[model samples]
Target: MTQVLGIVDIVWRGRNIPVEKGAKFRLGGIKNTAVTYGRKVGRAQEFQGSEVMATTELEAGQRWGNTWDPGEGELQVVCDTGQTFVMYDAFLEGDIPEITGGEGGKIELKWAASAPEEIGV
Candidate 1:
């Protein structure tokens, strides 16, 4: 089964926009091996009963003005290699600068073979 390695929350700032919770979000891997966009995309590729390690969760809420703050929640996701990544409570809008603006964040993950013994098990 796939397992999650790490989760990092992200916040992208747009013209006249605030980083809020529950906003449309997407995630991709550094290896360019996996890429997910839109809610539909995320839902289509959610974790499948895998016991993966997650450090943080997705945030929730809405923007009222120029600023938005997404609280935090798990991003139900299964890595390309049967691993699941469920981010917990941190913002990760620094990985994808093109999408999340110049600021980037990341959610690190690894397969059972590549993961550290402390996390991969």
Candidate 2:
């Protein structure tokens, strides 16, 4: 079955955190830093790709529970089209809920590379 990338379900640990239809997620993006290189005329900077990670923003109603904490676990990002990516030793960041008026809060999740060796130069 073909999985749709536009819509996906975020499974933390084992439970599914319901998300809004327009929920945004950045899956497996390039993480990199710039380095100065010596050039004949001048110095140039370049962006080198680093470890891959995932970032997501979820609506208030989609929040998992009352507490927002980073636990040692795996985050399963499954797309409706059937594609799935398992983030190993995953942890959450920017999980604070922002309240605006009577609307549900919005929480952001940043899944970083767990292993230090993978990110080592």
Each model's C-alpha lDDT? 0.29, 0.52
Give the best candidate by lDDT: 2
Expressed as tens digits, the lDDT of each residue in 59-107 for candidate 2 is: 5455445325666566666766666667667666544545444444434
Error of 1 at 78 (Å): 1.8
What global local distance difference test value does model 1 have? Answer: 0.29
Cα RMSD for predicted model 1: 16.4
Model 2, backbone clash pairs (residues 3+ apart or across chains), number: 4
What is candidate 2's TM-score against the reference?
0.52
